[model samples]
Target: MTDSKLKVALVGCGQIADAHLGEIRRILCARAVAVCDQYLDLAKQAAARFGVPGVFTDLGKMLAEVRPDVLHVATPPHTHRPLALQALAAGVHVYVEKPFTVDVTEAEDVLAAAVAAKRLVCVGHDQLYDPAWQECRDLYQRGELGEVVHVDAVLGYDLAGPYGRVTASDPDHWVHRLPGKFFHNTIAHALYKITDFLRDEEPRIFATWFGALPGTDCPTELRVFLQGADVTANLLSSSAIEPSQRVTRVYGTRRVVEVDLDGRLLRQARAPTLRGPLVKLELPWRQKREAARSLRRNLWHFLRSRLHYFTGMHRLFTEFYQAIRTHGEPPIPYAEIRRLMAMMDQIFRSCRANERLSALANEERRLNGQPVPISPLDPPLTTHHSPLTNP
Candidate 1:
């Protein structure tokens, strides 16, 4: 544990902030010094629950009076850019939630602010910390999985009950009142994970398909064509399921791996050897169980699976601590996050236009004045094209 404790301010008191608070307690070098929210009562509640002494409804005032070392922007997506810019301008490290901003343009502005302030700016893409995903990525990098050929990821659930109502609420409601679109909130996590694993070559969308959600105007389906590793990645999400589930599959030349969202179990299948038509092997789970035993062990695994939940908060505090101590970039840098925002914009545009959108490649060509090269890992753009039908 670090000897110095970093003073942290949480800017939102929503449901996700509770998870952030938990992580803050876990990190011995951090303390929640202040809380801010549009709702004073909510802010007060968070402060009381977390043992924070300062509470305010205005972030500007909190920055002025408390001058927190780090500001955690846990507010809605639309407010992410402004709040993050404010924190960066104040010379405070910022940890903003996913979909960093509503649009790529706003994302660029956030990046510029971070560069100008010389302060670290990290976005919450916490799933990268999951042990299972980390293990899979490590193996892939070691050439154990061979060349990744395809990726199929699904992030969706049925929400026909109370959850459905929340998703279908008025546009003014915090849940539904996004400045840009809902895809950024829901699918960005999966996309980030996908891109992280396939970082060698960037994937461009060749096509998109969409569906309807009962209560909301959000697109329910996004089938994207990745034109790099001869692969296709399909991302499907909906607010219409009874219970939610997330699964990711990576198909490689030598083996196939599947990981559930919680990262509890990672199942893999390798190519057949000379023994017969097929030879299958599984990771050593029995040995894993023997290595550790206790409630804390299981709880830690559970925490690892939901690591993304606390990423923003953890990053916010960690960056602030690092900024004051070492003066370096945060865990998540701004350039990579800008790429994520741009990728999301392309995905949503493809979904809305009912066609494969080449926004990213087009932008690259416009900037560099060169024809985009084919991505070896992505499927051919012209082969699997399913365009979205605009409403």
Candidate 2:
């Protein structure tokens, strides 16, 4: 670690910026030097909150004046590409928010810019730092669960009544009008976790589909099938109910592991019994003993898990800092992010078309120089006229 703290510029003062700010405050090797946003007041607010000396409505001005070592882009989906490219071109490292960009083309552009500039670009897939998921990955790697046959992940929430009303009133709010669905918003976390366990093997989207509920603009249920290393996984998301829940279930021949949104893991497998079958069945001694053992195991795992989780968090920020220092690749490579964006495009198309869409199929068509088929049911792209542009 270097003795001098790195100067960092925060672009876009949004909800997510607060999380990054919290982490930056804890990191002794980095300090926020400036804040920027199109909305000058928002930028001022962030700068005041963080005690950053510089605030600007223009990123170029901030870059020129602050000469920050790193630029954290937490803007809306649409602004990510342009802002990140600018930062990279200015020879500054960039850390971007999730859904790297609204489209794969944009992601590729950003990646190409990074490559040309020899800068680092890291996406905020922070869930990878969660300890519970790390423990699950550890177990799988140790072969305690055998080969992962299949993975089922589901994330859902209720956003109809009050939430919908509020969002409707502020449709331009990035969260409300983000280019994609909850799958794109939440699945990245699950995808990152699973990819950590299955490294080097690129996951391909086999199918993507969605369904609707009675009263929601978003899909009621979203499903995606991914294949890798002869293993297939299904990711599902829904917004049809209250008391939101997230779960991941991985099945293997030897045992089944269940993980909740918070990364709690429960493993079930058959073990040798000491007591007679009749006695064990009637008294359930094995069950009792296993439960007690599980409690102790969970506590020990929890402590270790917390440390690992925070360590991963530090690693992520550290990588971002080093990327700024050395102009190298990030922990989560841009190629992976491009793949994610491509998969997300297929997901949105499938949801809109109400049919299974294949990302590989589209890529093949594009590679062959064939025109990709368009779905008639797909939502029309939103159109907006810029006030600064002449009619």
Q: In model 2, which range of ten residues has the least summed lDDT?
A: 382-391
Q: Tens digits of per-residue lDDT for model 2 on 1-391?
A: 2557898889988766776776787677898888888998888888788788898999999999999988999886778898999999899888888878888899999999988987788898766655555566777778888877788877665656554444434544455355564455556766665555443334555333344333345444666666677566777666654556667777776667666544344445444445567765744665566456656766786777533334455657876786565645577877778877776675565444433223444556688797765742342222422111111
Supply candidate 2's per-residue lDDT for 337: 83
Misplaced by over 4 Å in model 2 are 158-183, 196-217, 263-315, 323-329, 355-391
C-alpha lDDT values of all predictions = 0.68, 0.67
Q: Give the TM-score of candidate 2.
A: 0.74
Write one digit per residue (lDDT tens) for candidate 1, span 240-322.
44356677888888888776655345667654443442222223443244234323444775677843444434555555466
Model 1 Cα shift for residue 24 (angstroms) = 1.0
Question: What TM-score does structure 1 among the candidates reach?
Answer: 0.77
lDDT of 2 at 217: 54
Looking at model 2, how many pairs of residues clash?
Answer: 0
